[model samples]
Target: AQSVAQPEDQVNVAEGNPLTVKCTYSVSGNPYLFWYVQYPNRGLQFLLKYITGDNLVKGSYGFEAEFNKSQTSFHLKKPSALVSDSALYFCAVGGFKTIFGAGTRLFVKA
Candidate 1:
């Protein structure tokens, strides 16, 4: 069985601080991990992905993720937080079917 888990329901950070949204996955074979952001009442937007090659993969809006084969984790990271960056994030793993995380809400405080 393949699945994705977003350990945190919400993440809070100061406007200028770095932010991370944790994600872990379980799958049978080589996994394709992806990060998507969703604004309020909007569809999910592709942020970044880790299909193959390179442990660290960069994505939109200064976002990046490191695929850890040992840990089976693909954690999303941002160097600095922004108020406009506040949104809901989802972690998905591709297998026979795509499994999406519960979705984490990010809050950037000024």
Candidate 2:
């Protein structure tokens, strides 16, 4: 069974502070990991991906993710949160078909 779990339904961060949205997964072979952000009534924007290589990967909007194979986790992070960064975030795994977690709504207060 392959699946991704975003434990948090929502994450609240004060502007300028670092933020993190947790994610964990289960897969048979090496997984194609991805992070995407979605705004109200908009399509998801690709943030980053972990195919195979370095554990730490950086992506758009100053976002990054650390892939922990032992823990089966790939957590999203940012140094400073922005109000504009407040949006829905999703953790996904790619294989025969892409599977997405429920999603985490991030709120960056101004």
lDDT of each: 0.95, 0.97
Candidate 1 lDDT, tens digit per residue, 1-110?
A: 88999999999999999999999999988999999999999999999999899999999999999999999999999999999999999999994467899999999999
lDDT, candidate 1, equals 0.95
**C-alpha TM-scores of all predictions:** 0.97, 0.98
Model 2: residues with Cα > 4 Å off, grouped in runs: none
Residue pairs that clash (backbone atoms under 3 angstroms), model 1: none
| Native-to-model Cα distance after best TM-score fit, residue 1 in candidate 2, in Å | 2.1
**What TM-score does structure 1 among the candidates reach?**
0.97
